[model samples]
Target: MHIFLHQFADNAAFNLRRLLCAALLACSVMTGCARYVDKPIDAHASSLLAPLDPQQISADTKAHPSTLLPVLDIDPTGPWNDMQIGLIAVLTNPGLKAARAQGGIAEAQVFAAGLLPDLQIGISADHPDSVGVVNAYGISAGFDIAALLLHSATRAKAKAAAAEVQKNIAWQEWTVANQARLLARRLPFLQQQQALATDAENTAQNLLGLTTQNVDAGNAKLDDLALRRVALLDTTERAHTLARDIETTRLSLNQTLGATPEQRLPFAAKSIARDFSTLDANSLFETARSERLDLRALRDGYQSQQAETRHAILAQYPMPVLTLNRARDTTPIYSKGASVALTLPLWNRNRGAIAVAEATREQLRIEYESRLHETRAEIATQLTELQRIATQSELLRQQLQQMQPEIQALNNAVQRGDVALVTYETARAAHLDKQIAALALAQAAAEGEVTLELTVGVLLWQ
Candidate 1:
């Protein structure tokens, strides 16, 4: 009898140890299945600003159809138009690319939020020697119903945030497009201005040389020579200033097109004359209110915050988790049951979170209204400026028309030596300057038109 009792005790101890080991293994498997992945930083990520490859953009477009474009479909090479330049900037601008990545992150979070929670299992064992009980183990699977209840709201918020990102990107694209159009329109005038400045410099240099020769030959006074030299210096300085201005303008245009500074672009298109005769202020106001991308983003953000606030209010209640449990003991005693755990809301009722969410929602509401007012004001301002510029441009055009015949007569007389060459050159330079001013005004009006279209979220120019 004693030997049998001892063997029974030894077997019980061994079974207890096995049960403990099995419990530990189950826990380890449940928790350690997902390993950490090391994401090594790429050393070449700084090369994003390198010249864009059409093929790479195409491949990326295929990978992330929503985030990028097939630039290869467009003429990725030379002579990019306004829309093409905007597209290239959208595809290749580092800031916009990063914004696209951030939107993807929000989309991924929405996907994650919509997913059902993972099943949970619990294991327990009792030592027979200490507790005088048989070896036992229990497994439980459960999920948080509170999380399930909040899933819709969470997913809505995530999706709204993603929409906001897209709208923000559209606004950014509009800004780049406006800048590109303006600069491209201004390019010809800038080139013409530089050329005129160069001509003036050359004429002044020639006059200075003639005056110096006359002075040396005792045919002109020293005062005349001094005056000619001063004129040459002034014209040279003006030429140098204009050259710098042309270089700077080219650089800006290249940057807007996402090209290298040295890259030559086709800017031969004349200044665009946008007709505003059909534009009604009231209609434009309504359009801006309805279609503005930034305003749409603000609305999206407000919707997201509303959902978050709802979720926060709902979360103040008890978070109940339902568990399905199974247990087995060494003595063939098996059990199956269901249980529930509740998070009592006695201490923290989420009041602070609710307050914060409510305040944020109100703030967004006011912000939306404020932005609406600002949008209207901005559209009005642009319209007024465009009108003013249009009037000035028309008057300048008339002036140019009136001056052309006089200038031609002057040119003919100078060719026949009836008038001084210097006098004719001065008149020609004045006319060219007027032309440049008119072109600059047209470019400004074009930019205003772009801004108005961007505000209304449509291509009015087309």
Candidate 2:
């Protein structure tokens, strides 16, 4: 009877061990089947520099696609303003897209950190050769309590990192948008300068022709005709250079919009904007400390480092594990109990990680301070530039206003033969030069205003 009982117990233990092994094997197989597989590489030229279609780019945005889609249908014969150009850049700039994707990565990490740690299941079996004894089998399951305790801070760090990414993305978008705005804002002024250069070239050519005729007829000095020809050449070169600059500026605008350089981008003909001379620099600096995205990102980074430091400190303590276990033996004995697990801190105490985390926090703190200092300086410099530009633009406007009628009178006198041809031509060229200078100053003032707004992390125009 004793031998039969022992056999029955051995059979029961063996069957239980087999059942547990089979279950574990099936779980492993299912998990292995669900593992990620890499896709085959298709080698080809990347699309980094590909011409972006406004409609397609709009549709690809994660949100607010409708805001940009309609911009494609807007009259291409535009009086398109800074806002329109900024919108296009915000929706299509590749730099901003890359920065935004980083935020997504951080978000995924945050989700991963919030998830519960996987449960660990373990099984073991032993067999004895004695006839009265039988196989022994044990099964246990547990989770790391240290991981559970560290979850809050780890998730906090990930969340902070995600916030930092978002701020960086916002700052990048602002950079792209500001570039497009400045280009669009100044393009019309460049166009006007080109047109004026053309006019000056045309006038010089006509004067050179007239002077050549007079010299051929022995009615004017050859030296005077030579001087006119030289002036014509100079003006022609200036016109060509200005034409090239205008074309380049347009292409730069296209690049900012993430479109082809050959694409014609229409912008408003007027280039002037409201004067920002009265904006208090100190006030803007204060606003920027709170509102600048880059600065905010630094603050977020510091907070994340703080959480990491906390997590590293916690890691210095030993990890505690609690497991529930079941065991059976061929002697007809069965038991169930809870087990505690812990690691001794005699060897590794996470001191290196803690020190690294502390050092990183300090680095972020200094970076934030350095950025704030630089931001203040930028605000001051841009404000001073705005004032100087306002004054310079005003003076140029006055000069232009005073010279226009004088140029007209000189033209009339030259046509009526009341003034010397050389004198009239010189005055006309000087007047055109003044007009170009005034337009350039106006553009400078407009751009200065935009830059000041950008520095302050505020949209003055909007």
Candidate 3:
């Protein structure tokens, strides 16, 4: 009995030593595993308040090619035209930066998806409470065969998703840049309107003062004095309204450029660089249908959905987990074998997932078609409106020119005391009104140009 007990103790000690070796190896492996470090977020905002120097941006862009869409060779200190301002907005806009960061995560996801999963390892231990029994243990090593089969489709989907994300980010950057361009174009026109309104206001104030003097002397009718006061009020309101619009547009432009609200820019008088009068709307829409970043992103999204659908369909097949194991039991029997755990396509068969994936693909198809139609219609509408503005602007310019001779005649007549001062003032204010209208049309044309560029996803401006 003592001999048997010593033999059992010897077997137990051997098993215990084997278990200790396994534990030591596991510890060694865990030492090479990933460790986490604390990462804290900053409480304060890290917004860049001041703009980068233009020359430095130009230099940097030259040294390391700019990734900006619709890249331009911009002279920063030169005229801040629509394209130049747009480039600036793309460079500095906070929203675009955040979007690009999201795109980076998408790219990283592609890398992760391409990686092969690690082999699974499992260990089991059993202890016997009575004598004539030894310690038992099992060790298994293998992988999910189903995951290996689906890897190609999964990686393709991730790649397509990453491409879609990047294209969408580019589209967003284009939109923000165009917004800044529109406001920059608008600011100058608002300033011009204010100047014209100021001239009219000055003329009306003089006329009102003269009319009041004549009324006090019983030389002017009360109705004429009332007319002069009304004219002065109209001019004053116009000036104030234009001034307010200017300030508002300035603030908006600064915000789009990622600058402080009160920041000032050297706004140029002429904002439009290229003419769309020659380009047919139909032709432009055709080009945009293929070239627009958003549309391209939709195609990429559709491709990714296709991949997802394929993956789901592939999943309907039986998934298998293959493992090879070596074990020793409490009876002192040793074993080694390979086994497979297969998931049968019973009632489920991954039908729900397949259906969902196909439905999602169909939804993306519908969305892309709808967006295409909207894009075409908007291009046509904006182009037609821009043409109308140009026509109106031309007509107004002709009218102003036609009035120039009469205005000169009125000036001479007033100097000779043959025309009333109020009459000359009325003619001057009317000319100013036409000038303001012309400026409005011009500003609308500039803004429309930017919108069209954004819609078409091409730089029409040189």
Candidate 4:
């Protein structure tokens, strides 16, 4: 009984040890799983709170502040003033370069067209007595005159078309460059307005701070502070909007200048000076009619079409063919002779070609008329816009002059604390609004003036 009891006690001890080991293994597994889950969560939280790198912060701080462009030193006595940037662009543009190359091609075509038909030569050998012997060797020369005549007219039309294409290309390049210069000039003024908006925002913030201080000192109500804060926020947002617009304009101007957006450019604030020297609109229109390259190109096209129609009608009468042939033969019978050949106009008269050419000439005439009418209408519309904007600009200038003293008085009153905060704020806002409006009016007037100058071929920029 004692042995059995001892064995039972040993068995009980072994079971207790096994239970303790199992419990320890389970605890270890659960602790490892908990640690694995917590690791990712902790890492994510740390990443969220990570501070910005000092190097990046310093680099950003060192970036240059945006600045207004400086004025360019344009030569007053140079031919550059007489010619607009448009003319320069036309001279330097790649499209015009390609068009000019077409002139060389047209010249080559003339050579091809005027070439006389190639002479034909033939040689024959015969064997008479089992040994090869030169029985007959002949050379013949012949040409068709009709082919040359047709080619000459075609070459002339090609040359005329090439010339018109070159002129049209030049006109297009000039228009694009003119528009670019105008846009570049306007960009600086837009930037100036953006800066003004920034100043207004800063002023609003300063006023808000002052109001907050007054409220803290029991000199102003909480509502007054809140109102000033709201105003400041509104002004700040306006400044931001204006700044964004200015950036967009700047990028567009840069693109026009053929520069990357990151590249810096200097474009001065430019205003169109009123030309005390004014020419009659009718006179200007006449000058444009004579000087405009696109119009001249169209006229050239019409003349070419007329020439083509005449050539095609002439083609209906089969061109008389004149051929000269010379042949030499030796061996079986020796013969040498020169003969002239001619073809009668019998079956094929170019009636279809004549009809097509006449129809094309009519189409060209219609196109020319349409282009002229459109150009004249454009000129009239641009002139009217220029006049209207000029009148509006003068009125705005007068209004600004009249408001100057009043704005100054209001500014002084606010600085002296004689005006209520809300009254001062409102007056300041009005002044700023008027200034922005005046600037916009001025810009529109300048644009219109430039457009008129372009339409009339009056050079505006040096």
Per-prediction TM-score = 0.80, 0.84, 0.90, 0.67
Write candidate 3's Cα lDDT for 65-133 as tens digits.
435445567675766676677777777777888898999899999999988887777666677789878
- What is the number of residue pairs that collide in model 1? 0
Per-residue C-alpha lDDT of model 2 across residues 101-182, encoded as one tens digit per residue: 8888988898999998988987666677677776776777898899899999999999998899888888887777778888
- Once fitted onto the true fold, the runs of candidate 3 whose alpha carbons sit more than 4 angstroms away are 1-32, 43-60, 63-79, 272-276
**Stretches of candidate 2 above 4 Å error?**
1-21, 25-79, 126-133, 206-234, 329-338
**Residues 94-119, model 4: lDDT tens digits:** 45456657667766765665666754
The backbone clash count of each candidate, in order, is 0, 0, 0, 0
Candidate 2 yields a Cα-based lDDT of 0.78
RMSD for each of the candidates: 5.4, 4.8, 4.2, 30.1
Query: What ranges in model 4 sit over 4 Å off?
Result: 1-134, 147-155, 202-257, 275-280, 320-331, 335-348, 458-462
lDDT, candidate 1, 354-375, per-residue tens: 9999999999999999998887
Error of 4 at 402 (Å): 1.8
Candidate 4 lDDT for residue 47? 43
At residue 141, candidate 4 shows an lDDT of 47
Error of 3 at 172 (Å): 0.7
Q: Model 1: which ten-residue window has the lowest total lDDT?
A: 64-73
lDDT of 1 at 166: 76
- The model with the greatest TM-score is 3
